[model samples]
Target: MDGQEGKATRKGPGAPRRNWRLYGVTAVGLAVVCGVAAAVGQVVRAGEASAVEAPKYAVGSGGGTKLDLPVRPTVPVTLTVYEDPRSPQSRAFAQRYAATFSHLLASGQLQINYRLVTQSDKQYGGSGAKEAAAAAACAEDQGRFAQFMDQVWQHQPAPANDALKDRNLLTGLAKKAGKINHDAFTLCVDRGQRNGWVAQSQSEFAAAGLGEAPVVQINGRPLPVPPAQLTPAELTSLVSDEAQRVATAATP
Candidate 1:
Protein backbone atom coordinates (compact mmCIF):
# COMPACT_ATOMS: atom_id res chain seq x y z
CA MET A 1 0.00 0.00 0.00
CA ASP A 2 2.85 2.45 0.69
CA GLY A 3 4.47 1.63 -2.66
CA GLN A 4 1.21 2.37 -4.54
CA GLU A 5 0.96 5.79 -2.76
CA GLY A 6 4.55 6.72 -3.81
CA LYS A 7 3.85 5.84 -7.47
CA ALA A 8 0.67 7.92 -7.44
CA THR A 9 2.61 11.00 -6.15
CA ARG A 10 5.32 10.67 -8.86
CA LYS A 11 2.74 10.41 -11.72
CA GLY A 12 0.84 13.51 -10.52
CA PRO A 13 4.05 15.64 -10.49
CA GLY A 14 5.16 14.38 -13.92
CA ALA A 15 1.87 15.58 -15.53
CA PRO A 16 2.32 19.21 -14.33
CA ARG A 17 6.04 19.22 -15.44
CA ARG A 18 5.01 18.25 -18.98
CA ASN A 19 2.45 21.13 -19.02
CA TRP A 20 5.19 23.67 -18.05
CA ARG A 21 7.30 22.71 -21.12
CA LEU A 22 4.34 23.52 -23.38
CA TYR A 23 3.88 26.89 -21.69
CA GLY A 24 7.62 27.75 -22.17
CA VAL A 25 7.39 27.00 -25.91
CA THR A 26 4.36 29.32 -26.25
CA ALA A 27 6.15 32.13 -24.37
CA VAL A 28 9.20 31.98 -26.69
CA GLY A 29 6.97 32.08 -29.80
CA LEU A 30 5.15 35.17 -28.53
CA ALA A 31 8.45 36.93 -27.75
CA VAL A 32 9.71 36.35 -31.30
CA VAL A 33 6.48 37.76 -32.75
CA CYS A 34 6.73 40.94 -30.63
CA GLY A 35 10.37 41.51 -31.58
CA VAL A 36 9.67 41.24 -35.30
CA ALA A 37 6.76 43.66 -34.98
CA ALA A 38 8.91 46.24 -33.22
CA ALA A 39 11.65 46.04 -35.85
CA VAL A 40 9.13 46.60 -38.66
CA GLY A 41 7.67 49.61 -36.88
CA GLN A 42 11.10 51.19 -36.55
CA VAL A 43 11.80 50.74 -40.28
CA VAL A 44 8.51 52.45 -41.19
CA ARG A 45 9.28 55.37 -38.92
CA ALA A 46 12.72 55.86 -40.47
CA GLY A 47 11.25 55.88 -43.97
CA GLU A 48 8.78 58.59 -42.99
CA ALA A 49 11.52 60.76 -41.51
CA SER A 50 13.61 60.53 -44.68
CA ALA A 51 10.61 61.53 -46.77
CA VAL A 52 10.13 64.65 -44.69
CA GLU A 53 13.78 65.76 -44.92
CA ALA A 54 14.45 65.22 -48.64
CA PRO A 55 12.72 68.41 -49.92
CA LYS A 56 14.93 70.70 -47.87
CA TYR A 57 17.93 69.78 -50.01
CA ALA A 58 16.17 69.95 -53.34
CA VAL A 59 17.98 72.24 -55.80
CA GLY A 60 16.25 75.01 -57.82
CA SER A 61 13.17 74.53 -55.66
CA GLY A 62 13.24 78.16 -54.59
CA GLY A 63 13.28 80.96 -57.16
CA GLY A 64 15.59 84.00 -56.93
CA THR A 65 18.46 83.77 -59.36
CA LYS A 66 19.69 81.06 -61.69
CA LEU A 67 21.46 79.68 -58.61
CA ASP A 68 18.25 79.24 -56.64
CA LEU A 69 18.55 81.43 -53.58
CA PRO A 70 16.91 80.39 -50.32
CA VAL A 71 13.43 81.87 -49.98
CA ARG A 72 13.40 82.86 -46.33
CA PRO A 73 15.63 85.67 -45.08
CA THR A 74 17.60 85.22 -41.89
CA VAL A 75 19.15 88.59 -42.46
CA PRO A 76 17.25 91.41 -44.11
CA VAL A 77 19.43 91.59 -47.25
CA THR A 78 20.87 89.65 -50.21
CA LEU A 79 24.36 89.98 -51.71
CA THR A 80 24.90 89.23 -55.39
CA VAL A 81 28.48 88.88 -56.56
CA TYR A 82 30.53 87.75 -59.55
CA GLU A 83 33.23 85.20 -58.73
CA ASP A 84 35.93 83.66 -60.88
CA PRO A 85 36.90 80.24 -59.59
CA ARG A 86 40.56 80.67 -60.53
CA SER A 87 41.12 84.14 -59.10
CA PRO A 88 43.32 84.22 -55.99
CA GLN A 89 41.32 87.03 -54.46
CA SER A 90 38.09 85.16 -55.08
CA ARG A 91 39.58 82.04 -53.53
CA ALA A 92 40.69 83.93 -50.44
CA PHE A 93 37.33 85.59 -50.06
CA ALA A 94 35.57 82.22 -50.27
CA GLN A 95 37.87 80.61 -47.71
CA ARG A 96 37.60 83.53 -45.32
CA TYR A 97 33.90 84.28 -45.62
CA ALA A 98 32.52 80.79 -46.21
CA ALA A 99 31.91 79.97 -42.57
CA THR A 100 30.16 83.22 -41.69
CA PHE A 101 28.10 83.15 -44.85
CA SER A 102 27.07 79.57 -44.22
CA HIS A 103 25.99 80.42 -40.68
CA LEU A 104 23.96 83.46 -41.78
CA LEU A 105 22.31 81.48 -44.52
CA ALA A 106 21.46 78.78 -41.99
CA SER A 107 19.84 81.43 -39.81
CA GLY A 108 17.98 82.82 -42.89
CA GLN A 109 19.59 86.27 -42.51
CA LEU A 110 21.26 86.46 -45.97
CA GLN A 111 21.20 85.10 -49.52
CA ILE A 112 24.13 84.84 -51.95
CA ASN A 113 24.17 84.16 -55.71
CA TYR A 114 27.27 83.86 -57.90
CA ARG A 115 27.77 84.66 -61.58
CA LEU A 116 30.83 82.96 -63.13
CA VAL A 117 33.05 84.82 -65.61
CA THR A 118 35.98 83.62 -67.71
CA GLN A 119 39.20 85.66 -67.84
CA SER A 120 41.05 83.26 -70.06
CA ASP A 121 40.68 83.65 -73.83
CA LYS A 122 42.56 82.29 -76.90
CA GLN A 123 45.05 85.16 -76.83
CA TYR A 124 45.73 84.41 -73.17
CA GLY A 125 45.60 80.67 -73.88
CA GLY A 126 42.41 80.44 -71.85
CA SER A 127 40.70 77.81 -73.97
CA GLY A 128 40.99 75.36 -71.11
CA ALA A 129 39.70 77.87 -68.59
CA LYS A 130 36.81 78.70 -70.88
CA GLU A 131 36.00 75.00 -71.05
CA ALA A 132 35.91 74.80 -67.25
CA ALA A 133 33.38 77.64 -67.03
CA ALA A 134 31.22 75.96 -69.65
CA ALA A 135 31.48 72.63 -67.87
CA ALA A 136 30.42 74.42 -64.71
CA ALA A 137 27.42 75.80 -66.55
CA CYS A 138 26.57 72.31 -67.81
CA ALA A 139 26.77 71.03 -64.24
CA GLU A 140 24.39 73.85 -63.41
CA ASP A 141 21.91 72.24 -65.80
CA GLN A 142 22.09 69.08 -63.72
CA GLY A 143 21.67 71.08 -60.48
CA ARG A 144 25.26 70.40 -59.38
CA PHE A 145 26.57 73.96 -59.90
CA ALA A 146 27.14 74.75 -56.22
CA GLN A 147 29.12 71.54 -55.65
CA PHE A 148 31.22 72.04 -58.79
CA MET A 149 31.94 75.63 -57.81
CA ASP A 150 33.09 74.53 -54.37
CA GLN A 151 35.44 71.94 -55.83
CA VAL A 152 36.88 74.26 -58.48
CA TRP A 153 37.59 77.00 -55.94
CA GLN A 154 39.19 74.59 -53.50
CA HIS A 155 41.54 72.95 -56.02
CA GLN A 156 42.53 75.78 -58.39
CA PRO A 157 46.02 75.41 -59.90
CA ALA A 158 48.50 78.27 -59.88
CA PRO A 159 48.61 80.47 -62.98
CA ALA A 160 51.62 79.49 -65.05
CA ASN A 161 53.02 81.27 -68.15
CA ASP A 162 52.47 78.33 -70.51
CA ALA A 163 50.68 75.41 -68.95
CA LEU A 164 48.77 73.04 -71.24
CA LYS A 165 45.04 73.75 -71.26
CA ASP A 166 43.66 71.27 -68.77
CA ARG A 167 40.30 70.47 -70.32
CA ASN A 168 40.90 66.89 -69.22
CA LEU A 169 41.39 67.85 -65.59
CA LEU A 170 38.25 69.98 -65.39
CA THR A 171 36.19 67.25 -67.04
CA GLY A 172 37.55 64.75 -64.53
CA LEU A 173 36.35 66.94 -61.67
CA ALA A 174 32.87 67.15 -63.21
CA LYS A 175 32.78 63.37 -63.62
CA LYS A 176 33.64 62.89 -59.96
CA ALA A 177 30.60 64.98 -59.18
CA GLY A 178 28.56 62.39 -61.17
CA LYS A 179 28.39 64.67 -64.20
CA ILE A 180 29.77 62.12 -66.62
CA ASN A 181 28.51 63.60 -69.90
CA HIS A 182 31.70 65.41 -70.78
CA ASP A 183 30.99 65.50 -74.50
CA ALA A 184 27.74 67.36 -73.99
CA PHE A 185 29.26 69.92 -71.65
CA THR A 186 32.26 70.37 -73.91
CA LEU A 187 30.02 70.99 -76.90
CA CYS A 188 27.84 73.44 -74.99
CA VAL A 189 30.86 75.39 -73.80
CA ASP A 190 32.56 75.34 -77.21
CA ARG A 191 29.54 76.56 -79.18
CA GLY A 192 28.91 79.38 -76.67
CA GLN A 193 25.25 78.50 -76.50
CA ARG A 194 25.20 80.00 -73.03
CA ASN A 195 27.03 83.16 -74.04
CA GLY A 196 23.84 85.16 -74.04
CA TRP A 197 23.25 84.33 -70.42
CA VAL A 198 26.87 85.09 -69.58
CA ALA A 199 26.66 88.42 -71.40
CA GLN A 200 23.51 89.35 -69.55
CA SER A 201 25.23 88.71 -66.22
CA GLN A 202 28.20 90.77 -67.35
CA SER A 203 25.92 93.59 -68.36
CA GLU A 204 24.32 93.51 -64.93
CA PHE A 205 27.74 93.69 -63.28
CA ALA A 206 28.90 96.55 -65.52
CA ALA A 207 25.68 98.48 -64.98
CA ALA A 208 26.30 98.15 -61.25
CA GLY A 209 29.86 99.54 -61.85
CA LEU A 210 31.57 96.43 -60.46
CA GLY A 211 34.94 96.27 -62.20
CA GLU A 212 37.16 94.47 -59.70
CA ALA A 213 36.91 91.02 -58.23
CA PRO A 214 35.00 90.56 -54.94
CA VAL A 215 32.52 93.26 -55.78
CA VAL A 216 29.66 93.08 -53.27
CA GLN A 217 26.22 94.55 -53.82
CA ILE A 218 23.78 95.06 -51.01
CA ASN A 219 20.10 95.32 -51.93
CA GLY A 220 21.04 95.98 -55.59
CA ARG A 221 23.47 98.76 -54.56
CA PRO A 222 27.24 98.38 -54.35
CA LEU A 223 28.71 98.36 -50.84
CA PRO A 224 29.62 101.93 -49.81
CA VAL A 225 33.13 100.59 -49.42
CA PRO A 226 34.84 97.30 -50.27
CA PRO A 227 37.07 95.79 -47.63
CA ALA A 228 40.66 95.17 -48.70
CA GLN A 229 40.54 91.71 -47.15
CA LEU A 230 37.36 90.69 -45.44
CA THR A 231 37.68 88.67 -42.24
CA PRO A 232 34.90 86.43 -41.04
CA ALA A 233 33.97 88.79 -38.22
CA GLU A 234 33.91 91.76 -40.59
CA LEU A 235 31.75 89.88 -43.05
CA THR A 236 29.35 88.90 -40.28
CA SER A 237 29.09 92.49 -39.08
CA LEU A 238 28.76 93.87 -42.59
CA VAL A 239 25.99 91.48 -43.47
CA SER A 240 24.19 92.08 -40.17
CA ASP A 241 24.27 95.88 -40.59
CA GLU A 242 23.15 95.71 -44.21
CA ALA A 243 20.29 93.43 -43.29
CA GLN A 244 19.03 95.91 -40.72
CA ARG A 245 19.42 98.83 -43.13
CA VAL A 246 17.46 97.06 -45.86
CA ALA A 247 14.69 96.14 -43.44
CA THR A 248 14.45 99.75 -42.27
CA ALA A 249 14.43 101.10 -45.84
CA ALA A 250 11.60 98.78 -46.81
CA THR A 251 9.34 100.23 -44.11
CA PRO A 252 7.11 103.25 -44.96
Candidate 2:
Protein backbone atom coordinates (compact mmCIF):
# COMPACT_ATOMS: atom_id res chain seq x y z
CA MET A 1 0.00 0.00 0.00
CA ASP A 2 2.99 2.28 0.44
CA GLY A 3 0.82 4.31 2.91
CA GLN A 4 -0.81 6.39 0.21
CA GLU A 5 -4.44 6.84 1.10
CA GLY A 6 -7.30 5.83 -1.24
CA LYS A 7 -5.43 3.21 -3.22
CA ALA A 8 -4.16 -0.34 -2.69
CA THR A 9 -1.07 -0.92 -4.79
CA ARG A 10 1.67 -3.50 -4.40
CA LYS A 11 5.36 -2.56 -4.27
CA GLY A 12 7.73 -3.55 -7.06
CA PRO A 13 8.63 -7.22 -7.32
CA GLY A 14 11.90 -9.16 -7.69
CA ALA A 15 14.29 -6.38 -6.77
CA PRO A 16 17.64 -7.44 -5.36
CA ARG A 17 17.90 -6.93 -1.62
CA ARG A 18 20.84 -4.64 -1.20
CA ASN A 19 23.04 -6.26 1.42
CA TRP A 20 21.33 -5.56 4.76
CA ARG A 21 22.62 -6.12 8.29
CA LEU A 22 21.34 -5.05 11.67
CA TYR A 23 23.42 -2.78 13.87
CA GLY A 24 23.68 -3.92 17.44
CA VAL A 25 22.29 -1.83 20.31
CA THR A 26 25.83 -0.77 21.21
CA ALA A 27 26.87 2.86 20.98
CA VAL A 28 27.23 4.17 17.43
CA GLY A 29 30.53 5.84 16.54
CA LEU A 30 29.45 8.40 13.99
CA ALA A 31 26.93 9.08 11.27
CA VAL A 32 27.79 8.44 7.61
CA VAL A 33 28.14 11.41 5.27
CA CYS A 34 26.75 11.11 1.76
CA GLY A 35 29.31 11.46 -1.01
CA VAL A 36 28.89 14.13 -3.65
CA ALA A 37 27.55 13.29 -7.11
CA ALA A 38 30.01 12.83 -9.97
CA ALA A 39 29.15 16.24 -11.31
CA VAL A 40 30.98 17.62 -8.30
CA GLY A 41 34.69 16.88 -7.99
CA GLN A 42 36.06 14.27 -5.60
CA VAL A 43 35.41 14.74 -1.88
CA VAL A 44 38.08 13.89 0.67
CA ARG A 45 37.03 12.31 3.96
CA ALA A 46 39.40 12.09 6.96
CA GLY A 47 42.43 12.23 4.60
CA GLU A 48 41.05 9.43 2.38
CA ALA A 49 39.82 10.12 -1.14
CA SER A 50 37.70 8.03 -3.50
CA ALA A 51 36.21 8.72 -6.89
CA VAL A 52 32.85 7.39 -7.97
CA GLU A 53 30.81 8.85 -10.79
CA ALA A 54 27.52 8.18 -9.08
CA PRO A 55 26.12 9.99 -6.08
CA LYS A 56 26.97 7.91 -3.04
CA TYR A 57 25.27 8.50 0.29
CA ALA A 58 26.18 6.70 3.49
CA VAL A 59 23.70 3.84 3.43
CA GLY A 60 23.00 1.06 5.87
CA SER A 61 23.63 -2.55 5.00
CA GLY A 62 19.96 -2.34 4.12
CA GLY A 63 19.46 1.23 2.83
CA GLY A 64 18.85 4.80 4.03
CA THR A 65 20.81 8.03 4.60
CA LYS A 66 22.32 7.93 8.06
CA LEU A 67 21.63 11.34 9.67
CA ASP A 68 22.42 12.43 13.19
CA LEU A 69 23.15 15.54 15.22
CA PRO A 70 26.77 16.64 15.01
CA VAL A 71 27.11 17.28 18.74
CA ARG A 72 25.56 14.04 19.85
CA PRO A 73 27.72 11.65 21.86
CA THR A 74 27.64 7.88 21.56
CA VAL A 75 24.08 6.59 21.82
CA PRO A 76 22.21 3.31 21.79
CA VAL A 77 19.39 3.74 19.27
CA THR A 78 18.90 4.42 15.57
CA LEU A 79 15.55 5.09 13.96
CA THR A 80 15.23 3.58 10.49
CA VAL A 81 12.65 5.45 8.47
CA TYR A 82 11.16 5.12 4.98
CA GLU A 83 9.42 8.01 3.32
CA ASP A 84 8.32 9.24 -0.08
CA PRO A 85 8.41 12.97 -0.61
CA ARG A 86 5.23 12.86 -2.67
CA SER A 87 3.24 10.91 -0.14
CA PRO A 88 0.88 12.91 2.03
CA GLN A 89 1.44 10.51 4.89
CA SER A 90 5.16 11.06 4.73
CA ARG A 91 4.68 14.81 5.02
CA ALA A 92 2.32 14.45 7.94
CA PHE A 93 4.67 12.06 9.66
CA ALA A 94 7.52 14.52 9.31
CA GLN A 95 5.46 17.38 10.66
CA ARG A 96 4.04 15.32 13.45
CA TYR A 97 7.39 14.16 14.71
CA ALA A 98 9.49 17.26 14.18
CA ALA A 99 9.66 18.15 17.86
CA THR A 100 10.07 14.58 18.97
CA PHE A 101 12.92 14.24 16.53
CA SER A 102 14.68 17.26 17.94
CA HIS A 103 14.30 16.09 21.47
CA LEU A 104 15.57 12.64 20.68
CA LEU A 105 18.49 13.80 18.61
CA ALA A 106 19.58 16.39 21.14
CA SER A 107 19.33 13.88 23.94
CA GLY A 108 21.80 11.64 22.15
CA GLN A 109 19.34 8.78 22.53
CA LEU A 110 18.56 8.47 18.83
CA GLN A 111 19.83 8.96 15.28
CA ILE A 112 17.81 8.60 12.08
CA ASN A 113 18.64 6.78 8.89
CA TYR A 114 16.23 7.93 6.18
CA ARG A 115 15.36 5.84 3.16
CA LEU A 116 13.56 7.76 0.43
CA VAL A 117 11.06 5.53 -1.32
CA THR A 118 9.58 6.14 -4.78
CA GLN A 119 6.75 3.63 -4.94
CA SER A 120 4.28 6.38 -5.71
CA ASP A 121 6.17 7.15 -8.90
CA LYS A 122 5.17 3.74 -10.17
CA GLN A 123 1.61 3.77 -8.88
CA TYR A 124 0.75 7.38 -9.64
CA GLY A 125 2.46 7.56 -13.02
CA GLY A 126 4.93 10.36 -12.40
CA SER A 127 8.61 10.82 -11.56
CA GLY A 128 8.08 13.31 -8.75
CA ALA A 129 8.99 10.94 -5.93
CA LYS A 130 12.20 9.85 -7.58
CA GLU A 131 13.14 13.36 -8.65
CA ALA A 132 12.35 14.84 -5.28
CA ALA A 133 14.38 12.18 -3.54
CA ALA A 134 17.32 12.81 -5.85
CA ALA A 135 17.00 16.53 -5.35
CA ALA A 136 17.03 15.99 -1.61
CA ALA A 137 20.19 13.94 -2.00
CA CYS A 138 21.68 16.89 -3.85
CA ALA A 139 20.75 19.05 -0.87
CA GLU A 140 22.48 16.49 1.28
CA ASP A 141 25.69 17.37 -0.52
CA GLN A 142 25.46 20.86 0.93
CA GLY A 143 24.50 19.59 4.42
CA ARG A 144 21.03 20.99 3.91
CA PHE A 145 18.95 17.87 3.38
CA ALA A 146 16.78 18.49 6.43
CA GLN A 147 16.18 22.11 5.52
CA PHE A 148 15.62 21.33 1.84
CA MET A 149 13.10 18.66 2.72
CA ASP A 150 11.27 21.10 4.96
CA GLN A 151 10.90 23.33 1.94
CA VAL A 152 9.79 20.41 -0.17
CA TRP A 153 6.89 19.56 2.13
CA GLN A 154 5.99 23.23 2.44
CA HIS A 155 5.76 23.54 -1.37
CA GLN A 156 4.76 20.03 -2.32
CA PRO A 157 2.17 19.98 -5.07
CA ALA A 158 -0.75 17.64 -5.18
CA PRO A 159 0.03 13.98 -5.74
CA ALA A 160 -1.43 14.02 -9.25
CA ASN A 161 0.08 17.42 -10.00
CA ASP A 162 3.46 15.86 -10.84
CA ALA A 163 5.26 19.20 -10.57
CA LEU A 164 8.50 18.06 -8.89
CA LYS A 165 10.40 17.57 -12.17
CA ASP A 166 10.22 21.31 -12.76
CA ARG A 167 13.76 22.52 -12.19
CA ASN A 168 12.59 26.03 -11.52
CA LEU A 169 10.42 24.92 -8.64
CA LEU A 170 13.17 22.72 -7.19
CA THR A 171 15.84 25.37 -7.58
CA GLY A 172 13.59 27.98 -6.08
CA LEU A 173 13.10 25.79 -3.05
CA ALA A 174 16.87 25.38 -2.79
CA LYS A 175 17.16 29.13 -2.62
CA LYS A 176 14.60 29.17 0.15
CA ALA A 177 16.72 26.67 2.11
CA GLY A 178 19.28 29.37 2.90
CA LYS A 179 23.10 29.13 2.63
CA ILE A 180 22.91 26.45 -0.06
CA ASN A 181 24.97 26.87 -3.21
CA HIS A 182 22.27 27.90 -5.65
CA ASP A 183 24.28 27.18 -8.81
CA ALA A 184 25.42 23.74 -7.65
CA PHE A 185 21.96 22.82 -6.43
CA THR A 186 20.39 23.85 -9.71
CA LEU A 187 22.99 21.95 -11.69
CA CYS A 188 22.54 18.80 -9.63
CA VAL A 189 18.76 18.89 -9.92
CA ASP A 190 18.81 19.66 -13.65
CA ARG A 191 21.35 16.99 -14.51
CA GLY A 192 19.64 14.29 -12.44
CA GLN A 193 22.96 13.43 -10.88
CA ARG A 194 21.51 11.60 -7.90
CA ASN A 195 18.85 9.69 -9.81
CA GLY A 196 20.88 6.51 -9.61
CA TRP A 197 21.17 6.81 -5.84
CA VAL A 198 17.44 7.42 -5.54
CA ALA A 199 16.72 4.34 -7.67
CA GLN A 200 18.94 2.16 -5.52
CA SER A 201 17.25 3.46 -2.38
CA GLN A 202 13.86 2.55 -3.76
CA SER A 203 15.07 -0.88 -4.81
CA GLU A 204 16.38 -1.56 -1.33
CA PHE A 205 13.05 -0.44 0.12
CA ALA A 206 11.11 -2.82 -2.11
CA ALA A 207 13.47 -5.69 -1.47
CA ALA A 208 12.73 -5.41 2.25
CA GLY A 209 9.07 -6.28 1.47
CA LEU A 210 7.91 -3.31 3.49
CA GLY A 211 4.29 -2.56 2.75
CA GLU A 212 4.04 1.20 3.04
CA ALA A 213 5.61 4.61 3.29
CA PRO A 214 6.29 6.42 6.58
CA VAL A 215 7.78 3.33 8.19
CA VAL A 216 9.69 3.79 11.46
CA GLN A 217 11.89 1.13 12.93
CA ILE A 218 13.60 1.19 16.32
CA ASN A 219 16.79 -0.83 16.36
CA GLY A 220 15.90 -2.56 13.07
CA ARG A 221 12.36 -3.45 14.14
CA PRO A 222 9.12 -1.61 13.47
CA LEU A 223 7.39 -0.02 16.41
CA PRO A 224 4.80 -2.09 18.18
CA VAL A 225 2.21 0.31 16.86
CA PRO A 226 1.96 2.13 13.56
CA PRO A 227 4.00 5.34 13.74
CA ALA A 228 1.17 7.60 12.60
CA GLN A 229 -1.03 6.28 15.35
CA LEU A 230 1.47 6.84 18.13
CA THR A 231 1.51 9.84 20.41
CA PRO A 232 4.79 11.61 21.20
CA ALA A 233 4.72 10.41 24.79
CA GLU A 234 4.25 6.85 23.66
CA LEU A 235 7.14 7.15 21.27
CA THR A 236 9.34 8.59 23.97
CA SER A 237 8.38 5.82 26.31
CA LEU A 238 9.18 3.24 23.65
CA VAL A 239 12.62 4.63 22.99
CA SER A 240 13.32 5.17 26.65
CA ASP A 241 12.37 1.62 27.43
CA GLU A 242 14.70 0.33 24.79
CA ALA A 243 17.51 2.53 25.98
CA GLN A 244 17.01 1.26 29.48
CA ARG A 245 17.00 -2.30 28.24
CA VAL A 246 20.26 -1.76 26.43
CA ALA A 247 21.76 -0.14 29.50
CA THR A 248 20.70 -3.02 31.64
CA ALA A 249 22.37 -5.49 29.30
CA ALA A 250 25.57 -3.50 29.20
CA THR A 251 25.82 -3.31 32.99
CA PRO A 252 28.76 -5.27 34.32
The best candidate by lDDT is 2
Question: Residues 99-185, candidate 2, lDDT per residue (tens digit)?
Answer: 999999889888889989999888788898998899999999999999999999899898888898777888888889888998888
Model 1 regions lying over 4 Å from their true place: 1-76, 120-125, 161-165, 178-187, 203-209
* Steric clash pairs (candidate 1): 73-108, 74-108, 74-109, 75-108, 75-109
> Pairs clashing in candidate 2?
2-213
* Candidate 2: residue 55 Cα off by (Å): 35
RMSD of each: 12.1, 32.9
Predicted model with the maximum TM-score: 2
> Which residue window of length 10 is worst by lDDT in model 1?
61-70
For candidate 2, the clash count comes to 1
